[model samples]
Target: MRSGRLSFSFTMLMIGIAFLYVPMLVLIGYSFNASPLVSVWGGFSVKWYGSLLHNRQLLDAALLSLEIALLSSTGAVILGLLAATALVRFRQFRGRLLLTGMINAPLVMPEIITGITQLLLFVSMAQMFGWPHRGLTTIVISHVVFCGAYAAVTIQSRLITVDRSLEEAARDLGSTPLRAFWDVTLPMIMPALASSWLLSFTLSLDDLVISSFVSGPSASTLPMVIYSKVKLGVTPEINALATLIIVAVGACVVFAGYTMRRAERQRDQEMQAAYRQPAG
Candidate 1:
């Protein structure tokens, strides 16, 4: 009975993996087809990739997307770190639950609503302060708002897992609160910080709807470019671009996991060594 159950579970797991990977496999396969129509494979060719590289507009849009992702993710990490610290350290405060809920509300809210709200706010700000017209800055700001929520949640969970005694020990050893945080708490949460930053970056880079609503005519993102092209019709070029993005993101994920595992191993080794040392 146990063997039968294990086989069934294994089969189900394989089915789930196939379900997730089959579409991606199809996309990658079509990317190599020479035909303009993705459905029909004329022959294998690299022309689509070459064309993608030469498309100035697409390149510009990609650059803009990168810039926005970098700025928005960085801003989100900073804001999220502060919010997470506040949430964890100031647990006695009134409305803590309400504030936490507000911070995480974006995760559940509809993207269209968030987009519309950001659009209206940008318009209002521009009209009131005669601020710079909405474009990349506005899009970045909108992304940061949502991205920060995700980062905060990630960081907060990690913070809760950390031992409070570490910080207390640091403080008891004559470290100021700030020093204790930097020396003890921050180091402990470095992995969470790294993970949160990358998560925010990926989220911002992949965002389309909110960025579309907030961005002006001049600041088109990679997703916007892809969406416009997709509206006309699918092409091998798009498939090629999608495949490239998949490969790049996959590589990044693999590298991050490898680095994190290495760090954890080193940490474990250090702990072992310390335990083996003679006590003074």
Candidate 2:
């Protein structure tokens, strides 16, 4: 009975995997199709990808998206790190709960609401200050607002796992609090920072609703371009683009996993070597 149950569970897991991945597999396969209709498969051809190179508008939009992603991700990481540090280190402050709630409120709020609110604020600011009428800057600001919340949550979680004793020990050894943080806490949480940055980058790149609301005529992101094209008609070019993005993200994830594994292996080897060394 136990063996039968195990076999059943394995089969269910396989089915779940197939259900989740089959659509992506089909999309990737169709990227090579010669037919314009993505649903219908034609003989393999690289024309779509080749055309993508020549499409100046799409290329420009893609570049804009990359820029927004980079800038917003950087901003998010900086703000999030500061917020996370405050939340973790200044736990006794009054209004801590309120601050935490405000920091996390974006995560649960509807995207439409967030977009509308940002748009209103941008318009008001523009009218009042006559600054940043509309463009990449506005979009980056909107993205940073949302993405920072996610980064803060990730970094705060990592902080919770760290031992405070390490920092205390460093302080006792004549290191300033800031210097101790740099030497001890920073190294331990570096992985979380890297992860948070990547996560924010991906979120900013993939954003559509908030970006669309805040963006002006000059700044069109990749998602906005893709969305506009979808409204007109679905094209094989979109499939090709989607496939490329999926492959890029997948490669990054794999590379990160490999690097982490290598670090672990090196650490294990060092520990084993130390154990094997003569008693001191």
Candidate 3:
């Protein structure tokens, strides 16, 4: 009976894995098609990737998306760190409940509604101040608002798991509060920071609905451009572009996982060594 259940679980896991990866495998395979028509494959070819270099619109859009992703992710990480620190470090504070609600609201809110509300807010700010012309600035702000929430959630969970005594011990050893945080607590949560930053970058890069609502006519993100092109019809070039993105994102995820695992192992070794010490 145990063997039968194990076999069933393994079969279900394999089926789930195939369900998720089969579409990506098909897309990657089609990316190498020699023919322009995505439906008909002449042969394996790298011409579409080469052709992407000359596509000015796609290139520009990609560049813009990267810039936005970088800026927004940085902003989100900074804000998220602050928010998570506030929530975790302070046991009781005025407006703490309100702050928590704001942070988690984006997690449950529909993207379309979030986009629409952000658009309205931006329009009002524009009409009132005339400072932020709806374009890159607005898109970055919108991305940061939502991305920061996810970043905070990631960091908060990590922060909660952290041993506060480590920081307190550092403080007890002639280290100032700021120094303790900088030297001890920060290193422990570095993995969370890295993960949150990567998550924010991916979210900002992939954002379409919020971006479309906030971005002006001039600023077009990669996803927006790809969406428009896909509406026309999927081509080999699009497939190649998508394949490149999947490969790039996959590489980043792998790198992040490796780095985090290494850090964790090192941290564990340090803890073991410290515990073995004779309390010097």
Candidate 4:
């Protein structure tokens, strides 16, 4: 009976993997198709990939998306670090509950509601001050609002496992709280910070609904452009664009894994060497 259960579990796992990956595989294959029809699947060709260079609108949108992602990710990281620090280090502060709720509201709230609320807020601000418009600035700010929530979650999770005594020790040695954090806590949470930054960047890059609501026509993001194209019907060029993105993202993931593994091995070797050394 156990063996049968194991086999069933294995079959289910395989099915799950296929369900997730088969569509991606099909999309990648179609990206190279000579024909424009998605279902027809003509012989392999790279024409669509070549055509991407001349598609200036798509390129502009992609560039704008990158800029927004970069700015929002940095802003998210900074805001997230502060929020995470506050939540983890100062647990008994006034209005902590309210602050925590505001920070995490994006995680639980529906995207449509968040987007509409942000749109309304921007409209109100514009009317009140006439200082800003719905464009890259608004998009970046909206992206940071949600992305910082995710970043805070990631950084806070890492901070939870951190040894507080280390920071205390730094403080005991005449370091100020801010200096202790910089000297002790920051280094330990660098990995989490990096992960949060990447997550923020990815979220901002892939966002559609929020960008669509907040973005001006002059600052349309890549996802908005791709979404419109999909509505018309998926073409080989879009498939090709997706394939390139997949490849780039996959490469970055692989590189990050390799870098992390190498760092881990180096740390392990240092620990072993320290263990072998004579004590004072």
lDDT of 4 by residue, 1-280 (tens): 9999999999999999999989988999999999988778689899999999999989999999999999999999999999998999896999899878988889988888899988999989999999479899999999999999999989989899887987998999999999999998897788779878988998898999999988766778999989999999888889999999888877886787687667757856985897799977
- Candidate whose lDDT is highest: 3
- List the pairs of residues colliding in candidate 3: none
Ranking of models by TM-score: 3, 1, 4, 2
What TM-score do all the candidates reach, one by one? 0.93, 0.90, 0.97, 0.92
Off by over 4 Å in 3: none
Compute the lDDT for candidate 3: 0.94
Better of 1 and 2 by TM-score: 1
Query: What are the per-residue Cα lDDT tens digits for candidate 2 across 14-63?
Result: 99999999999988998899988766777999999999999898999999
User: lDDT of candidate 4 vs native?
Assistant: 0.89
What's the TM for model 3?
0.97
Candidate 3 per-residue lDDT, tens place, 74-106, comes to 999999999999999998999999889999999
Model 1 Cα shift for residue 232 (angstroms): 2.0
lDDT of 1 at 248: 92
